[model samples]
Target: MTVTVADCERVQTSWFQLRSQVLGSGSWEDDGLTWANGDLMFPRVIDPAALARGVERARSEGASIVGAWLGLDVDPRPLAAAGFKKGWAPWWMAGPIDLGLPADPRVELRKDAPGADGRPPRAWFAAARQGGQAAGGAWAHLVDDLAGVFDVEVPEPFQRRGLGTGLMQAVCAAAASAGARQVVLNSTPAGYALYRRCGLQRIGTGITWWLHLPS
Candidate 1:
């Protein structure tokens, strides 16, 4: 059951959709643009024309900044020409949910309860503490049997102590317990090596283009 790049893309989109819904924001697909409203909005663009339309729409809606996730195959020249500065290069990685890292005793995993209507939550959060102080945290979203991990962070002072790996182990364990068979994540350069050590392979790379509209 090797996951393809397309599978990773679908899971990423699902994560964003669930996030937008949970935040009470809106999302829509117009032409080649997939727009989701959030503090860090990524309007997935398929081509130069879609990028142009997305910029116009963001400006019309009074957004100060917006971003686009361009897959490796998408030419970034158009984005740069459109005044979008380059942003982070995130590696799309995926692997079996059993990451094999021993969980740290200090890490606590928590899952949201089902809604009043009995609908299960799409995501859960994990946090790691050192001496009863917050060291790091992360979020995992499940869409069907595939889970996507997001926002794994450890403070500077608390870093280099394996808290990041511990947080990942805890979240993957939680996802596996909840019936997820595979996990996917977009890893920045900082976390890329750690994720590789956890047995996830980089399936592809994506560039994020950011734009600040004129006032």
Candidate 2:
């Protein structure tokens, strides 16, 4: 089945729910459809009219206005004209198959336990180099049958070592273990190639907006 913007929204909603659980804030749907995750993240506003309302509310409350329009092919210049900075424009990818973990013993995968201070459970897959230093790490949140991957990063020295592939495999394993049936994520321009290599197919487009970088 072709994934649509609604599917992307489901992934985003699940992600923010997990984030809010960890951060002690809950997300609410504003203007009937936009999802706002408190002040921690921007509201997902699509309709220009709704976006205007959300923007005004954000400005009035001194909260950063940042959000995304997924799969909608809307021109973001209007939002840019409204004083929001256009951030990473990502391609939404989803795949049904789980690319299994790598057999290489040089890298290890570990699922970090929840913090003692009441943070919710999150999947942290660290790819350790042969020398024991981490080459990279990826974090994910699995809600029901959907998993949203985020913060996949590798240091410059670790590039070209296939650490990213290992991280993707580990993340898929963790998500499947948690009963996820499909994996969804917004990929960076650099990550697009990596994710495609790992069996995920690009399904849609996503763009984010920000008011100001917090100090």
Candidate number with greatest TM-score: 1
Candidate 1 lDDT by residue in tens digits, 2-43: 887677777777777776777755466767667776322333
Per-residue lDDT of 1-215 in model 2, one digit per residue for the tens?
A: 46555676676677776666666554556555454454313333345676666666545545554565444455566567666676777788888637765655655667778788976555656564746776777776776577778778888898888888777777777777778777778887888888888888987776666666242
lDDT of 2 at 39: 31
Candidate 2 pairs with clashing backbones: none
Model 1: weakest 10-residue lDDT segment is 37-46
At residue 179, candidate 2 shows an lDDT of 80
For model 1, the stretches where C-alpha displacement exceeds 4 angstroms are 38-53, 56-62
RMSD of each: 2.7, 4.3
lDDT scores in order? 0.79, 0.66
